[model samples]
Target chain A: MNFKLWVKPFENLAKKDRFTISILWVAMVLAYWLITTAGEKKFFPTPLQVWQGFAALYSEGLVVHIGSSLWLCLQATVISIVVSLVIAYSYPIPLLRPLSRAMSQLRYLPLTGITFYLTILVTNARTMQVWVLVIFMSLYFITSLLAVIKDIPQEEIDHARSLKCNRWEILWEVIVKGRFDYVIDVLRQNLAITWMMLVTVESILVAAGGLGVLIKNSDKFMNHGRIFALQIVILLVGLSIDYTLNTTRKSLFRYSKFN
Target chain B: MNIQYEEKDIILQVENLSISYGEKVIIRDVNFIERNVVRKEINQGQVVAVLGRSGRGKSTLFRALTGLVKPSSGKVLIPDYSQAPSNGMQPAKEVEEGDVGFVDQKYTLFRHKTIYDSLTFALRKSGEKGSEKKEKVMKYLIEWGLEKVKDQYPNELSGGQRQRVAIIEQLLSSGHYMVLDEPFSGLDIGNIQNARQSFKLIENGHDLNTIIFSTHDIELATELADSIYVMGYPRLDDGSLGTVGTIVRHFDLKALGIAWRTEFTQDHLELVKEIKSAMLAS
Candidate 1:
């Protein structure tokens, strides 16, 4: 073993060594939990107990709940992406700049306060849940996208003007088409925010039986083991989504890596 | 052999131009006129170089020339091709954005577009259609030796290929006028040679084609530009250097009997020295 290689800062590890260290690190975490929780504790559940709880939930229609949450999340995310892109891309126009600016700043407003108004306006439970998630994600998405648009170099716009592009064409070509990859990146960032809000939105409308409803039920009955297992599942799904978006960005915008 | 050339009617005119941001003046009192230069036995066009030190508002002057920035005081004029010439003189109008094409030092092509697609996009305003537009862009791609890299993105191209694409993009879009800001600032010998060839490709296309560029290399400026303008801070009444940039010297090489020559002679070196002294003084 090259001991110095492991000790040095910012040093690269061999792939085999990296894999070995990762596995060992996970094992160490598991061993620490087992060692520390010798006696039965109220809040802390053993790893095996959590696994059994997960298996029980899996048998009792957990897959349906996961699918329901995923479907709702997808709907809200799609709406957010489209709406945010429209506002952000139109930000350069003098007439639309103020509107876009106000929309981007909406992230600071309390989601619960907006939810009160949305419940009054939107009568249907499912529609209200979707709107809640959409509002939450769209605000953050607009903020991220506006930053990306703002960072675009002025020379690109000047180059477009030199090519005889009118104001609308400049907005389309330079501001919209030129920054599509950055849009995808911003989507990736804001998708995480959407996922974080998914449970809260789903729990508010329990008529829609979803992962959030399952979590709320487990919490109400003091089923700590089941709650931990469902939390683990939620974390894994979020990670998988993040991975997929990262791969999509890498594959679609191969040139973005150059920047 | 005396290379016979006639200076005809004005092609571009910048009259008493000044640009500023609030209280700070960048370039002031910048005035120059470029006329069509027709040479016998060969096709030639104007390659005017604006030589200046860093931060002397060469970029501001270029922004005005390209109509990207409105001048604070004066106007830039070019022939209004939308109207016909009256009594052997083309109708002149104030320049607007998109009148002159500009390529910066980075050779900034759209990062997402391939060379072929970028050229196609440049022709968006052109009234050509379908296969005709594609053919026109393809002809340029082939002639400039960029056909092989047509499908490749800008990052996939080398420095020379990107430069050609940038120049041709502007050539096809703006037509007749192209401005390059520090085209040769960070180039090596081979790449610089490629840039020189790119200039020829542009000049060979049209007699009215003009390439106005800025560079710090005195020797390269003398080698490329038939006319040179030195921009720097001028002496004030109190003998202090002024902050506002203005053209302090103009070298009309056409009158010096040195332009269009196959070689840079001792006279060119002497001229470079004179330009250097002028730059240092201002």
Candidate 2:
């Protein structure tokens, strides 16, 4: 009965999606338990050991590191979104088209290679890291948003104009409102990149105190349990954030439920 | 053909309207005639259908009427309501909100907004506020049998429902005139009939609203339009094909004793054949 109750929620999911998610979850947990317990070399710590490490870090005030990292990611993401919107919307204008096209090409440049130059350009390490992340995220964001904007139906713009909408009104009504779902989807897709760069930047700037710094400190002491715990924390945090964004998108664009 | 309505009763006029894209002319020298009078004007509350085959510039004519496509040489005239019209006609470009409403082939609706909100948003844009807007929306929702789907977003509705909503939104926003571009293309017979009924209800014998729609369906045009404008490519006097699309035939269905709600008898079918042949010949 309890199994039936628990499975009821998943009944609405597509059979294939349900199957995929169930198999992946079970396999991941099984592999984690088996590999940690059966290993003689103690290469991977047990789940209990990792849990103990998490508890210790939690009591030692790990929230500060998590909060700082989240704050920095939030700031960079907001800036990237604002800048990308401006570039994507204005790209149709002849004067701005070349600049937008040139900036979009920057996505092909590796973030790691650019970080070296960015560090030199900005004196402060933390500021440099943020700028590097902003640049990387903004380029990705601009390209995705431009593609979304391009896909907006011409009929929608014409419809708005027929309703006496001027250029600015058409921009707000058709371009912004029509592409809103895609915008949210783009943000969700690029968020993974933002988290990846956040870890890389924080780890490289060793003086910065963040989740990446915590992981680095654990690595220095050769504490596999703490390292695994911090890794798990980052994974969980990233997953939760992604889940929140998905929920937000679904809730805000409830009409998409039919689609 | 010469069709005339009183100057005060006419809502729209197209005067030697021609449209072209750079070196290519899409439509040229298109004109409509009043059945009796000398003035070539579409009377208020009259349904006008532009009939043509695909790519014969029916959609282009509609676009020019809506001012989306600028006319190459001539002008589309709508009555200017801002001032007492000196000539009873103003250029189509001068037509604003509350003057013309257009529904394209896609039946475009705001996917994010509910049917109720879509109506209210249009009203708000036209400067309506508060209880008046809500009252008007509710009244139309019930009148159109869309009350059940009032709170549902556009995507949740069926195609016919969405089309109805689009029509109602246009009617509420700009009631004076409407141009529907191929509104019956993908619809089933039942929905098409329902759409016709909706158009009839809006026109309502009051001669206040005017509608112009384009369709390739001869039967539909014969049934719905008070005056039918057949657009096609014509042979030019220079012994070469005319590049511009022009009105090849203009006639009033009522004047020919065709009733709007009459069954499709053999006579009606013959009329349809004649129109089809005329369309092809042009």
Candidate 3:
């Protein structure tokens, strides 16, 4: 392979070459970390120490904590997607335009501040956590979904109209059914935010005993190894979710995978 | 020699139409009428081509004709099916969106649906249901030579296949009039042949079907259209090109006795030269 091929901008490699480069880059990062942290395994704990920490976490029921986090994320994903789709799809309605636009802009607000009001409104800790995540994600989700609807080329809508579809049918055929691939794409993108907020929200309600609680407990003891280990777990789980969503999108709407 | 044909009552009419974006006039006073062209013992649809240079508002005129864009001054009228015909003439009504089939250059399709599903969805508003709907869609798919690829998604088909499917979709939904914007643009020689062949196939589908298309290729326009409209900026009293676009010249190939010929002739080349000269002056 031409080494220069790797640095060329926007270059697309064959699947085998692409996979080879990915593994090579990951190995380089591992090598760099192993070389740098050879002596002092103090502040930045070594991977071996982190592995031991991972083993310790497993003994302390890490699987259960992970299951809690995944469950919370899944619930928020489904609910937020439904609610966000409703708000975003309502953007074409003149009367509901303001409500949709307002919801889209709500993504900018700091997440923690809203939890206070939410706490007073909803008393149950678990329900409050779920609501907190749902609100946090729905805002970003709505913003993304609305943008997808807005960026739809006028040609597609015109094509739909030429097919004798009325206003409501146009909304259904063009906006909702046509671009559904992007919903899964947007979900994959916002799932990262969902996982990050999972830690933050779960930290608030310790009774939930999620990965966020484990993170909080690790922070209290200044256990850098355990925190690092939990971070890896979260990263892997997040990657898996992203992979699943991307697969679903590519399989269902085969056109979406087109370059 | 090609067989004789006669023009009947007006099928599509554009009267005193003008449209502007804010204060910038795009197309002004654009008027034309397409009558159903009936060949002796043969089904022949109307093929009206609009030829113009870039920025000449051909696209705007097409959008107006298709009722996708409302004109500022005048209206487009087509035969209204809601009412009965009188004295061999159909009643006319102002055209509205969904009244005309529009096939844009890209031939965009619903990304998620297969070709078969997309065509069925197009017929949903037609009120045809059960096996009848399936049979109708299947008939078009087979006639258009898209039966094998009917199960494929838009991404899986070639460009020409997608174009055929797009045209068939519009035909199934909106009965007759089809406005194709830049249909010949960017097509290779073979693909252009395919596109024209498909256009002829659709005409074979219905005698009342009309195709209004735009293209920059003057020679192709002369060969394909029985009636041609040349859209360009008009000359003002100051002897300068005006900003607004209009029909600077119209070519009735039928009157010239050069339409629907199997081969391009010297007369067609002469018309092409005339059109090019008109475009240059505009």
Whose DockQ is greatest here?
3
Q: List the residue pairs that clash in candidate 2.
A: B2-B34, B2-B35, B3-B34, B3-B35
lDDT of each: 0.89, 0.78, 0.88
Q: What stretches of model 1 exceed 4 Å from their correct place?
A: A37-44
Misplaced by over 4 Å in model 3 are A1-24, B1-3
Which runs in model 2 stand beyond 4 Å of their true positions? A1-21, A28-63, A92-97, A110-121, A218-229, A257-259, B1-10, B33-44, B85-98, B125-129, B236-244, B259-261
Worst 10 residues of 3 chain B by lDDT: B1-10
How many residue pairs of model 2 clash at the backbone?
Answer: 4
**Cα TM-score per model:** 0.95, 0.84, 0.95
lDDT of 2 by residue, B113-188 (tens): 8889889877866567688899989998899899999999887888788889988888877766789998898999
Better of 2 and 3 by TM-score: 3
Assess candidate 1 and give its lDDT. 0.89
Give DockQ: model 2.
Answer: 0.50
RMSD of each: 2.0, 5.2, 2.1
Model 3 alpha-carbon miss at residue B261, Å:
1.0
Clash pairs, model 3 backbone = none
**Candidates 2 and 3: which is better by DockQ?**
3
Q: What is the model-wide C-alpha lDDT for candidate 2? A: 0.78
